[model samples]
Target chain A: MENLAIQLENVSKSFKYFQLKNVDLTLPTGQIMGFVGANGAGKSTTIRILMGLMQADSGVVKVLGHSQPENQTLVKKEVGFSSEEMKLYGAKNLAWHIDFIKSIYPQWNQAYANELLKRFDLNLEQKIKQFSKGQQIKAQLLLVLARKPKLLVLDEPTTGLDPVARHEVMAELALILRDEDRTVLFSSHNTADVEKISDQITFIDRGRILDSNDKESFFENWKKIQVELPSETLLFRHHRSIGIEQAGKLASVTTNAFTPEILTDMQKQNIKVLAVEKMSLEEIFIANVSYRRQGE
Target chain B: MNLRLNPSMIYKLTTKDFLLFRPFLVVYILICALAAGVMIAPIEGAYYLGVILVITVSIGSGIHFALTSVIIEKKENQMSFIMGLPINATDYAVSKTVGGMVVYFLNWLPMLVITLSLIYFSHLPNGLIPISILCFLQILTGVVVVLCIGVGTGSEGFTIVMVVIFNILFNLFLSVVGQLPGISEFIQGNEAVFNATFFSVFGIEILALILVLSLTLFIKSRNACFL
Candidate 1:
C-alpha cells in the first residue's frame, strides 16, 4: 500500500502536571485518521508534535517523510492545520485572511476558497470579531482548506459549533477526503463524527494511546456480552481478559478480544449466554478508559 | 503544494491593522495639534511646549505601537494561523517589526515637522533639530525593544514592567551623574552627552534589529507544540 503520511515512534513529552508517554501513531497516505480522546487526554499534544509545533522530548516524529522540528519548514508547506484555540486577525475580514493565506501558499486554490466562502455563508468584508462562533469556525476551516495541503491536522474543528454547522464541516471534510490523495487527522470528543468519517481510529487517555487500529477492526474486536450465571457462582472470576460486572446471578462482561471461540469457551463452563452485543465506538471508548482505570 | 510569501497578503493584513488603529491615530493628531497651538501662545508655560510635544509623541508612539503589536495576535488567536502558512517564523517576526516601524514612522512624522517648525521660528533649544532627531531615534529604539519583549513573552504586564524599569533606571542614571563632582563638567567639556546620545541611539537601533532577527530564529527552532 502507500507509505505512511505521518508516523510517530515512542514519542514522549512531559510537563510539570501532565505527561505524554510513548505515543505511536501511523496514518497512511490516503486515509482519514480520527483521534478520539477526552479532555486532557493529550490528543492535542500529539497533534502539535506531529505538526512540528512542539518537539518530542524523546522518540521520533516524521510527517510526510521529514523529521519534525528540523524539517518543519518542508512539512509545513504540505500540512494544513486548524485548531479551536487559533484565531484570525480580529481587524481582518475573511477576504483579507483569504488573500493573506493565498499569498503565502503558492498552491492556493482561489476557486475553492470562493466556493467555501459561499458555502459557509460568510461575507468576505465583515471583520472576524463580528461573526458568530460557528461562522468563525467555518472561516478558520476555509482558510486552511483553501491552501490545499496534502495533510490536514484539525484539532476540535467542530467544538462549540451548532449541530448544523458541525454537519456542514464534517460534510466538507468528507468531500475533501473523497479525492483519495489527501489525508486528515482530526481530534474530537465527539465520537459520532469520528465514527462517520474515520477509516482508522486511535483512542487516547491519560496521556497514553489506548488503542489504534482500523475502524472496522476496532468495532469487531470489542464486545459486550450478558451471561446468566448460577447463584453464588462466578463465570469470569478467574478470567483475566473479561471485565465482569455481577448483579445477583446476571453478569455483564466486556472483552476487547471478542470472538465465537471465546463465547463457546464460556458456554463450556456452564454459563448461559443471555446476549451478545456489538459495542459502539463510544462504548468502546468508555470501556477502554474504565478498564485502564480499573487496572490502576 | 504551494510555498511562497505573498506581499499582497502582507499588505492586506497591514491594511487591516492600520484600520484598527485609525481612531487612535486621530486622537494622536488632535493631541499634537493642541500641543502645537499651546506652544505658540505667548505665556510662561509656552517655554516647555516643544519638549512636551516631543515627549508626547515619543510616549504616544512607543505605547501605541507596543500595544498594537502585543494585542493584535492575542486578540485574534492568529498565531496558529500565521504559523500554518508556508512562511517561516523568522519571516513572520520580521514582517511584524517592519510593519510596526512603518506605522510608528507614519505617526511620528507629522509631530516632528510641526515641532521643528515651531522651534525654528521661536529660537528655543538652539539645537532643536539634532535633539529632536536624537529623541526620535531613542523612541524608535524603545518601540523595537517593547515590541520584541511583547512578542517573546506574550504578556502585557511584563512589557509594562520592563518599560517602567527602563525609564526609571535611565532617569536615575542621568540625575546622579548630572550632579557628580566633575562628571557633569567632563560630560559638557566636549559635547560628549550629545555625541554619546547619538551613538547610543544608533547602537540600540542596530541591536534591536539583531535581537528581532535572533528572536525569529528562536521561534523557528522552538517546538511548535509549545506555541
Candidate 2:
C-alpha cells in the first residue's frame, strides 16, 4: 500500500445538536480526496480536527505519521492549510504576507508563488482588505501553495468565488495534482468542483460518512434505475439494495451493489426497466443525504 | 523536523509587528518627549522620576494590552496563521512576547535618556547608575509579567486587571517595608542594600522570564481551539 498521508480511525466528536460518529477516513499519498457534505454535515469540523486546530473527543488522528495535538507542530510543518474563514492581515499587502511566510518555511517556492501571483491577477502591492472576495481567496491560496507542503488541507476554498475565479482556482489545483507526491484533501458542497478534480470522493451527511470510494468505483457502483412496476406488485420492497423509491407503480432504485446480475434479477421479478441512468456526483450526494435524512 | 527558531523568521515577525505598531510608536515618542520636558524643567529630581515612571508604566501597559489583545491578533488573524506555522506554538508565543518587550524597551529608551540628562544638568546628589539600574530592572520585570498575563488570558481586560492589582499590591508592600523603622536605618547605615535589592530584583526578573517561558510552552503544547 502507498504510504497514507492522513488516517482517521473511528474518529468521533460530539456537540449538543450534532455528533460526528465513527468517521473513518484514509487519504493515501498522491491522491486528491474531495470531502462532500451538506452545510451542517461536519465537514469543516473534521478538517479542523485533522489540522490539529480542534481535538477529537475520541479517535485516533494521525497526519504524516504524527499523532495529533501532541505532534501538531511537526505535522503542521508538512501540511499546507487554506480555508474561506482564514484571512490574512487586512492592512498588510500581499507582499508582506509572502515575505512573512517565506521567512518561516525554508521550503517556500518563490518562483511558484510568483507564477501563481501572476496567474491569479493579484498585485502584491494591493492591500488584502481591498481585494474582492475572489481575489482574497486567490491570495490565500497563493500563500498556502507556495509553502510546498506534502499535504494540502483546504476547507471550502472556492465557496464565495465567481465562476471564472472558481475555474481559475480549480485549474491551479489541477496543475498541483500533476505532482505525484502531493496529497490534497478539500471539502466542498459544490459537487461539480469535486467531480471535476477529485480522484476519490467521500459523502458525509448528518455528521456520518454515508459513502467513500474512488471516483471511478463510486460511479461504477451506484446507478439510478428507473423501472415500471406491475400495478399489483411491490417489486422494490423485496429487493436487497442500498436505496429504492416507489411512486405508485413506478420505482426508482439506487444500488450500492450494481452489476449485470442485479439487472437480470430485477427482470426476473417482472419489473420493466424504463431507463438506467448514470448519476453524477451531485445526484449521488443529494440522494445519499436525502436517503439518510428520511431514515432509509 | 525543521524546528529551529531562525533569526530571519524572528526578524520578519518583529518587523511585521513593528510596522503594525507604527502609529503607537509615534504616540509613544510624543509621550516620552513630554515626560522628558517635565523631568528637565528644574523640578525636584525624585518627584519627576516617580511621575515619569508612573506615566511610562501606565502608558506601556495600556499600549501593550491593546496591541496584544485587540490590534495584532485582529489584524493578521494571527491566531490561525501562527497556529498553522511550522514552528512550535511555544516559539510563536515567545516571539510575540519578545516582540512586545522590544517595543516596550523602545518606548522607555527616550525617557531614560531624558532622565539621565536631567541628573547630569542638575548635579543631583543621587547616584544616576543605581536609579537607572533600578528603573531597568523594574521595567523589565513589569513587561514580562504583563506580557505573560496578556498571552495567557488572551484578553486585554484581564491584563489590565492584573496590572492594576499588581501595582496596588506592590505599592502597599513598599509602604509597609518603608514604615519598618529599622529597615531604613539599616539601609542608610550600609551601602550593600542597594546592590542586594538590585541583584535580587534582577534574579526575580530572570525567574519571571523562566516562568513565562514555561507557561507559554505549556499553552502552545495544549493546542487549544482557536479560530
Candidate 3:
C-alpha cells in the first residue's frame, strides 16, 4: 500500500450526460500508467477526482498514501498535476511562476529547473501569453517537473504539440522517471506516446475502464491475425475475435482473448493463416472500444 | 481527520492576489487622492464633486477588482491553476475575500478619513460625520457582496448583474437612511448625536458583510468542481 502512488477503489461520479462507475486503479511508485480514453470519455473527470479538484460521488481516492481531497493539501504537496484545462497566468513570466510554485513546495530544485529551461528552450523572462502552444505546454511541464514531486498526474499533456515538440516532451518525461521513487499517471488518446513510455496502461471509454494492464502484457494479450480464405464464402470463425477487417480473400481478425487455440480453430476451418501480428496500443484501444460499444 | 488551516498558505495566497491586483490598487489610490483633494478644496460645489468622486472610487474599484481579479480568474481558466496549487477551494475563497477587502479598504479608509476630516474642519454638522461613516459602511457592504458573489458563482455575468443591483440598492439605502428621524434630526441640529436608528443601520451593514463572507465560504467548501 505504501508503494502505490495512486489508488482508486469503486470510485464513481455522475453528471447530467456522463458517468464514471466503479473505477478501480492502482499505480505503484516507479511506474508510469497511461490513461487512454476518447473525447469526453471521463478521463479528465477521473483525473480531477484524484486531484481533489472534484469529489467522487462514491468510493475512495488515495494519492501518495493519503485519502484524496480529505488530505488533498498533503497529497498535493507531493503530487504535481498538469492538464490542458489548467492554464498558466498569462500576465506573468516563467520566472514568476517558478517563484510562486517554489514558495509553495519545499522540494523545488532550482538546478533542475534551470536545466529544463535550457532543454525546453523556454525563456523565463517572457510572459506565458507570448509563448506558442507547444512552448506553453513545455513551460507547464517544466514547472511541474522542477518541483521533484513524488507523483505526477498529467492529462493530455501532448494533445496539440507538433511531432518534434511531442518527442521533446516524451523524452523529458522519460528522463523524469529515472528516479525509482517517482511515478506518473498521464491520460491521453495519443497512444503512441503512451505506448512509448508507460509501464502500465488503462483504457477508458464512455465512463468505464475497459482494461488495465502492464504495457508488455497488454500488448502481448492483443493479437491481429490475417487469414486467407479458401473461397471467400466464410473466413475464419472464432469466439475470441472482437473485430474483423476483411479485404477480398484476406481477413484480418483482432482479438483481446488470444490463445494457442485460435490457430487450431483457424486450421480446422481450412483457413490459411497469412500472418499473426501484434497490435499497437492504438489498434488495441480502438478494437477494445469498438468491442465494448458493440456489447452495449 | 481534523481540518487544519495553514496560515502561511493563506498569507501567500492573499499576497499573490494583492500583487496581481496591484495596478488596479494604484489606480484606486490615485482616484482616492483626487477625491480627497476635491473634498478639502474651497471651490463652489466641491463637496458634491468630492462625494461623487468618493462613491465612484468605492463602487468603481469594487466592480473593477471583482471583474478583473475575481471574475477574470474564471474567464481565463486561472482557477484551475490556483486550485492546482497545494490549496483547496476554502483557502482560495478566503484569500480572494480577504485580499480584495484589504485592498478595497486600503483605498477606502484613507478616503473616508480625509473626507470626514474635511467635513469636521468645515462648517458641516458634526452629525454628518456619523452619517458619512454609515455611508462608508454601506459602500463596504456593497463591495463585500460583490466579492462574495464573484467568488461563490465564479461567473462574470452573474456577478456583474449583482454589482449593478448592489449599486442601485446602495443609492436607495442612502436615500432611506438619509430620511431616518434620528439622522434627519442630527442634520437639522448642529450637534453630534448617537441614535438607535443610526446604530441599527450600522448593525445591518455589519451583519450583511458577515453574512456575505460566510456564504462565500459555505459555497466554496461544498464546491465539487473547481474547473
Candidate 4:
C-alpha cells in the first residue's frame, strides 16, 4: 500500500440495516481496477469513503497518499469522481458549467473538453435539462475527464445507459486510459463492461470482498468442465473442484483451480471429458456467488 | 478550521448561490424602492402599509432564499455533485450559512434603517425605537433558525413550519416586550431611553444566534455524506 494509488485497510462502516465489515483493498498505481458488486453491495459506500464523501466507522483509507475525509480537499484536487446519482445544474447551459469548472481547476483542458463535446455530440449552448440521460452522462464524463485527474472513482457510471451509450462512454475511458500514470476504479454490476477494460477486478457482495484478481487469472483459473459420468454413484470431488452437479449420464464440474492434471486424473477415474469450456466473467461471478452462498 | 478547507472553493459556491438568486435580489430592490416611496408619500395610512410591506418582504425573502438554496438543493439531490468538489464539510457549511445570512442581512439592514428613520422623524413615540430594533434582532434570530433547520436537517416541511411559527411568535414577542413596566412607562416619551431590559433582550438574541450557528456547523460535519 506504500506506493499504491488506493488502499483501504480493515475498513468497516455500519448503518441501520447494512454493514461493511473489515474491508481491505489495494490498487497499485497505473492499474484499472473494476470493482464488481451486485446492487446494494457496498460499492457506492466504499467509493464514497475513498472520495472523502463518507467516513468509515473504523479503518484506514488512503487515496493518493492522503488520509480520507481529513485530507479530502488536498486529495480531491487530484481525484475525479462521478457517480450515477451526481447531477449538474439543470438551469444552466453546458457552456456555463464548463466555465465554472474551468475557473476552479487550473489544469482544465479546454481543447480536450472541446474534443469531448464533439465526440459525445453534445451542444454547449443547450441547458442541462434539455439533454437526454445519455447526453447528461456524457457531459458528466466530459467534466471529470477534461480535468485530467490522476485517479478516477466512478460508481456505476454506465448503469442505466443504452448499449450504444455504454460503448461510447467505455470507449472514451479506453482512449484516455492509455496514460500509464492514470488510475481508474470503475464499479459496475455489468461484468462485460468490467471485463472489457479492467486490468484487475474485485468482487464485492453483502458488504464483503469475495474475490480480487487480475483479469487474465480470472479467465485462466475458472472453467466449466463438462463430463460424461459412467454412473450416479460416483462422488465427484476433485482437489481443485469447486462444485459438481451430475444428471445421470453427464456431470458438470465448476473449478477455480483448473489445470491439465485435473483432466488427466478424471480420465484415470473412467470419466470421459466431453469439453473444457472457459467461463465468462459473468458466469464466474454467478458461480462464485452461488458457491459462496452454499457455505452459509 | 482544517487546513483542507479551501477558501476559493467556498467563494465559488457562495457566489454561485448569489447568481442563482439574482432574480430574487432584483425583486428585493424593487420591492424596497416601492416601500420607500410609500413611506414618504403624503397619502394617509400609506406609512403603515409601507412598514407592513418592508417586514413582509424581509421575512419572505429570507424564507425563499432558505427554501431554494438549502431545502431544494437536497431535495433535487444536488448535494452529491457539490460534495464531489475540493471542499471540507465544515467549509461547505460555512459557505451555505454565509451565503444565506449575507443575503438576509442585505435585506434586513435596509429595512432596519428605513423603519427606524420613519419612527425617528414621524409622530410615532421615540420609545418605539428600542422595541423596533429588538424586533429586527428577533427577525435575525428567526433567519438563523431557518438556516439551522434547512441547512442542517435538510427538511423542507419542517423549515416551512418553523417560518410560519416564527411569524406568529414575532408578533407575540413584540407585544410582550412593549408591555414591560420598566419600558412601557416611557412608551410616549420624547427621547428613546436605553434600558437594562433592552440590553438583556439583545444579549439573549446574540447568544441564541451563536448557539444556533455552532449547532449547524456540528450537524454539517456529521451529515456531509447524508446530504
For each candidate, the alpha-carbon lDDT, in order, equals: 0.74, 0.73, 0.84, 0.84
* Tens-digit lDDT string for candidate 2 (B1-227): 22345455455666666776666666766766566556545556855575556456544644464455333584556566666776454455556676666765665566566555555565343344444444544555566666767776677677778677756655554555444443434432313235555566557667876777577646654544442
* Cα displacement (Å) at residue B114, model 3: 3.7
CAPRI docking class of candidate 4: medium
| Model 3, residue A174: C-alpha shift (Å) | 3.5
lDDT of 1 by residue, B160-205 (tens): 8868865665455445544544334443232223456445555765
Per-chain TM-score of chain B, candidate 2?
0.69
On residues A1-296, what C-alpha lDDT tens digit does candidate 1 reach at each position? 57989999999999999999999999998889999999999998998888877778999999999998667767888998999888877766888777767766899999988888887789999999899888888898888888888898989888888898788878876776674576889899999989988999999999999999999998888888888885656554435354788888898888888778877887888788899888899989998988887787
* TM-score of candidate 3 to 2 decimals: 0.92
- What is the fraction of true interface contacts found in candidate 3? 0.71
The lDDT, on a scale of 0 to 1, for candidate 3 is 0.84
Score candidate 2 by DockQ. 0.38
- Cα error, residue A285 of model 1, in Å, equals 0.6
Q: How would you encode candidate 3's per-residue C-alpha lDDT over A1-296 as one tens digit per residue?
A: 35888899999999999999999999998888999998998899999999988889999898877987777787888888898877888988999889988998888999989988998889999999999888888898888989988889999998878898888888877776654556899899899989877989999999998999999997777999989988767554467888888888889999888888888888887889989999899989998998899999
lDDT of 2 by residue, A1-296 (tens): 67989999999999999999999999998889999998989999899888877789999999988888567767887999888777778878999899888877889999999888887889999998899888988888889988898999989999988998888888877776664567899899999989988999999988889989999987887788888876846654435465777888888888766787877877887888898889988988887787678784
Model 2 chain A: worst 10 consecutive residues (lDDT sum): A232-241
After superposition, candidate 3 runs with Cα above 4 Å error:
A162-164, A178-181, A259-261, B1-3, B117-127, B185-198, B222-227
